[model samples]
Target chain A: MYWNEKHECIPREELEELQLQRLKETVERCYFNVPHYRKVMQELQLEPEDIQSLDDLKKLPFTTKQDLRDNYPYGMFAVPLSEVVRIHSSSGTTGKPTVVGYTRGDITTWSELMARSLVCGGAGRDDVIHNAYGYGLFTGGLGVHYGAERLGASVIPISGGNTKRQIMIMKDYGSTILTCTPSYALYIAEVINELGMKPEDLKLKVGIFGAEPWSENMRKEIEEKLGISAIDIYGLSEIIGPGVAVECQDKSGLHIWEDHFLPEIIDPETGETLPPGEEGELVITSLTKEALPVLRYRTRDIARLITEPCPCGRTAYKVTRIGGRTDDMLIIRGVNVFPSQIEHVLLETGYAEPHYQLIVDRKGTMDTLTVMVEVSENVFSDEVRKLEQLEYTIKNELETTLGISVGVKLVEPKTIARSEGKAKRVIDNRKA
Target chain B: MLKQLSVFLENKTGRLTAVTEILAEYNINIRALSLADTSDFGILRLIVNEPKKAYEILKKDGFTVRITDVIGVEMPDRPGGLNGVLQVMKSEGINIEYLYAFLGTNGRGAVVIFRVENMEKAMEILQEKGIQVLSPAEL
Candidate 1:
């Protein structure tokens, strides 16, 4: 059940050789075309020729989300705009977004990689892929769409929302594979029960879920409710969308496609690369990207790399399901939301520095973000309408900025606990 | 016009009790009270005998409290007595934000507290309409 068996099952030595060659070429492209990479390399007194072996990747300066943002909308693109056929953007910490471009060749490579991921997750040409990931500026929807088409499978491209219609299509169209976030899968399962339709009525067999961190208990729940094999896939827009890695039928760990991307684990605090099987921040280097070839991009996602060969016979190394993030970024319904973003909205409301706390919880199948702001003397009003208006204003501003709906509550003054050091800002009740 | 102490309270057990306990400790008698609430939190509006002392004590206890000026009118305790005051305000085009009733200290009729948008206009209209408007001294 492998797609591109040659690359998936490449020998360890041969894979290393391919990775090294691609890494050098990518570095050269970045240095010659992208000024940010060139400037950083020059500052470090390093050149493209300095990267002789895979270990030399450490010598290269690490790219960060801030670096990409500093470059802005098109500065990070190694290729010209005419060569970049498609563009996608992910949520950034501040107001600006992290934009990614894909050249025609890059699109083809992404399709092939995603094809490999879908096949690894037990999707085939005969399977009908019901892709529920979003389809706009976000990468998940079209990423899976192109790959499903490349796999020669029937893709529904339903995107997200309209759950009842999706379920109807899943049953009527006889969709065999479900692609969405793991929490969404559970939600669909709940909808199935509420409609009095059993899982057997649907033709679903395999589910590939990603875009948010989910627990193993959730996997078990989805499997039991939907009666399908739940596989965890990992990827980020900065690292070429959803096909960076995926779990095979083995269900142990996601096999990183070492042919196109080189993955590394590093100590998040010290920036030193950690040994294999050691848990730290996962840094990725795009080995074959034409539009944006990132050099050791700090993902801010904490994970470990497993070099042991999987039972599925893929020689590519596997990474455990992402454990946590090195920062306080919350993925609410697949949208990245930072506490600082909410604070910016609150502060921009023209009030004095207000005490605020973010309460993240899973309400049913959806992730809910509730912003608890203390009702300070400056903002307090005797009129209930005025107070309610303040709450509405905060909610509207937060929704406008974060691009997500949030529950805003005006609690009593000093109700939010104050810490002596680094004040606690978020209370996430979602299970790890 | 009468001073009313309004305190923000979260919808949790012991929160309302905590406010009451603090008020009792400070010897501030709640002459008239009304609690407006939503799902998340509540606003406890109170007409106390000593509003300034109550507001200070509640502020010291970390309660988001505000002192608001409201019109306290003495109305008949009989049915439709509230309609009389409402009819006058409706005719005069004065907006009442919220209103609540409590027994008057004389124990003869009910005293209705009205939180209006324009306190001066509401007081002038009520007095011209021959309504008994109780002031802070009377409360």
Candidate 2:
């Protein structure tokens, strides 16, 4: 719960020495072997000799998501295509997807990081892991799969969907560690209720949920329903997927692997590195990656850095709960709002359900905000007047919670769209 | 006495008007009504004239109908009139959740429709107190 300056906890001279050694080798590997790296360095008027240590990373050009898209399929691969054994692509919801390639050694390193993540969540050799993250191009599924195997635990690659079958396997296998997106875990809990099954019978001990940002309120809900300690794992396909950082049992924040990937928080507007505990965009430099080494990649995720040693004895740097993406922030009537803020309001309002949609429209020059919420069954009553009263109560509570007036529309339960992966929480009609 | 009527309606907007218009066409009066509406389904409640004949006519017109026994009680038009009824129900352990009122003839009294938690207990207590329960005809 408390944060200490971990990087300073260690001798600064020693940390910098270690970083310089890793930086030297990475630069040598890039200049001599990778054509893309060589071309980028030459174009930026830089050489391996000019980059003496990790402190000189600022001299290098920063990589963006658009850079990956520009390279397309194999343009970013540092080695020959035959040396690459695996490939993964982004969700491609916004634009053309960025593709990543990994060599056999790269996978081994990935497995090791994932193993560390599972161990951080207290998964040992005897544990049975139910891996429910979506498979194929997404790294969540296979990323957890190899990690569980490396940890010498029993791995069940459920690969998502079919809640009934997922439960059957979970109950039969006695899964101790659950791995999937947080939304899918909630969906599985819903199925368990529909089938009239008690959660105590599942024997799940821990859950590693990621792939999208979630609030602490969601963690408590999942824990209460499934009777498991849910932990957050943060990653992206471009940055070696779900093993980038993980929550220790303390559940304070996720521990980023500083040795493997260097993390820096930068102001999105000024592009200057901010000090620890300051909220800004996360920029990462892969110190140990081979086949496709990324230099100062801008992740666009907004989070504050915690440089403290965890009670669980992890000395790595931790990042606060991901506030949201810089791009996902919406401007409604000139008020900057993130979907997480709406989630916070809904969770605080005990009468409102999580199944709500934000409707945004432009009325001439100003933006209008309307929230459509599905009434929870606990508030349902036989009297029509009470239903209307409940609607008014929700409207007032939300207006007070968000500091902005919003129209509240109550709808029947189970009328909203459901996703087994990444729940769509916003509906902006202004652009449409 | 008691009055109960069932009004039939389709699952559409303004369908309730059609049912009310039909009752108006026959000069039959309505005291109260409750409606349960789903997107594509609806059930209408009514306390109207000739409850039995209305049910038969509505059923003949391809409308589902049902009937319930709702008592019309006459009470003094004073402040404690409704309080006196509630006090008795509370003593008898009966809860009234929802209710409606009907217009009474000049200076005589008013009729109230109550949906109580325990209907049988409420009727027994009122009958024992020598209170008259009006039938649909009085309305």
> Best-fitting candidate, measured by lDDT?
1
lDDT of each candidate versus the true structure:
0.91, 0.75
User: Which pairs, if any, clash in model 2?
Assistant: B1-B133
Q: Evaluate model 2: give its TM-score.
A: 0.58
Lowest-scoring 10 consecutive residues by lDDT in candidate 1 chain A?
A414-423
* Residue-wise C-alpha lDDT for candidate 1, range A1-432, written one tens digit per residue: 888989889999999999999999999999999999899899999998999999999998899998888989999999899998999999866688899999999999999999999999999999999999999999999999999999999999999998999999999999999999998899999999999999999999999999999989989999999999999999999989999999999899999999998999999999999999999999999999999889999999989999887899999999999999998888888889999888888888867886899999998888899999998887888777888899999999999888888999988877788788455799999963
Give model 2's docking category.
Answer: incorrect
Q: What is the TM-score of chain B in candidate 2?
A: 0.77
User: Which ten-residue region of model 2 chain A has the weakest summed lDDT?
Assistant: A1-10
Predicted complex 2: DockQ: 0.03
Cα lDDT tens digits, model 2, A1-432, are 212235323454666677677777777676778677788899999998898867688777778877887788777777888898999876332335679989998899899889888988778888999998878887889999999899889999888778899999999989888998776787788789889998987989899988766668778988988988999999877888888988888889888877778888999888888889999999988877777888788988899999866777667789987876766655453233556666666676665447777887655323568877765545544444555676677778766655556887765444456688445667776555
Over 4 Å off in model 2, which ranges? A1-16, A32-36, A93-95, A329-432, B1-139
lDDT of 1 by residue, B52-124 (tens): 9998888998998888888899999999999998999999999889999988866768999998889998898
